[model samples]
Target: MIKIITKVTLAVLLLAVSVSKAQNFQGQAFYKSKTNMDGSLKIESSSMTEEMKQKFMESMKKEFEKEYILTFNKSESVYEEEQKLDAPEPSAGGMMIKMENSNDGKIYKNIKDKVSITEEEFFGKEFLITDSLSTYQWKIEGESKKIGEYTCYKATYTIPVSEKEKEEYANFKNKQTDSKTQFLMMDEPKEQLISVWYTPEIPISNGPGEYWGLPGLILEASFDKTVVLCSKLILNPKDKLIIKVPKTGKKVTKSEYESLVQKQMELMNSQRGDGKDGIRIEVHR
Candidate 1:
């Protein structure tokens, strides 16, 4: 009887392992912007930095230009609320974020460099978005880690000033790109350390954030010190969607394009409230 019980336990454990391995990591993206000096996370546009506002407008402009056909599947559970099976939140402690991934090709449209092709160009039209304006030497450094039961290799990419990058930096130093912020100078290299975690268990060359070119799926990613975690996996769910990059729009590099957007946003803000007689509210107590 004891032998039978032991055999049953072993069988159950093996089954669980098989099920876990079969599950693919399928869930909506949850983004948590780093906190601010006030110890709070600002969600709206009215409370963003000039650079942040510029990037936001740039995204909008790219969408308008590309006009890519976009679609999204309904939200799956984020798994935050364990008590409630129907509706699960990603994080139960403190604040759990709810976000949708910009799945369509439009998200890549703004990337504009050596990323992907659009729908407009001829058979062999070359559209160099960022014209070798800079080249930063990047290195991968870190320890190996495991995201799920899968073993993952962790690495850090450092943005250093290469020869081409320095030249662009000098050009930007002479003139400000726009009123929002000055461009990076050759000597002044802004360092950004991105931690990438990829597992060879899943054979796909993709990741959560900007890090890519791995043998398998990227389980987690971090940029500018903000972390994006993959909490769940859903293997081979029905109604699988295909990812194809679109190609039907005028191309523009990220930096130059963002400057144009910043100007427009600044103009709008000026009209709304530029230190002169802002929103008037008379509260009667």
Candidate 2:
């Protein structure tokens, strides 16, 4: 009788261990992001009426607010924006103006390997940008807050603009002949301060869109003019989530992609007479 009891106990322990391991390997997090559009719309336009500009700004604001889903496991994650119905293009002065959606891409990050791959589309051309994962020196503030049912702690970091970004900004400015518009672009800072809230309960050092290296999953992050917040989380769903790296598109490093884009912009500018008269191009990183 004693030998039989020991065998049953061992079997139950093995089953429990297997279940725990499975639970720790998969999760899905839903996030909603919004950007502050007030600064961007503050520029004075000579040709556009105030009412028309206000209407255009409203339309642009809608594009800045978006929804995303992050599927993650122990060491890897795939983050992509959720699909939504397209709205009609907003018109000003009898011309239809379209806002460029900057956050259209699939970001795959592998924390264990310290690598990141992003599939991006520019001017109808697709690119796969592979590079090292960015590391952050987070200063934990020892403050805590609750995001839904999970408790989160505060952390902050600073990031300086790269030379590539500076070059892009300069190119964008040179294309603008309006002094007011150029001044607005020049007012943008060269560095940004980021604040994040993460929960250790989840035990994953990943977040949405180039944010990671925290002690847990980031529930909320704010930097520059954008804020991303976690709205929901699901753990170990019945249907397994497969995290795969993007394989299609022209593969290039981060710096290489920037150079390619800059060269294309220069070519386009040279072809057009007084390119400043055309639609404004906002450089998106």
lDDT of 2 by residue, 42-129 (tens): 5345567778767766766777888999999989999999877876665556555443227568999999899999998888788999
Tens digits of per-residue lDDT, candidate 1, 83-201, equal: 22345333312223322112222332222242532222222332223322123233445568776687887766666556755665575455434333311112354666667677777
Measured against the true structure, the TM-scores of the candidates, in listed sequence, are 0.43, 0.80
How many residue pairs clash in each candidate at the backbone level? 13, 0
Q: Please state every model's RMSD to the true fold in angstroms.
A: 14.1, 4.3
Superposed by TM-score, candidate 2 places the C-alpha of residue 156 at a distance from the truth, in angstroms, of 0.8
lDDT of 1: 0.42
- The residue ranges of model 1 lying beyond 4 angstroms of the native Cα positions read 1-114, 117-138, 160-189, 238-240, 246-256, 265-274, 277-285
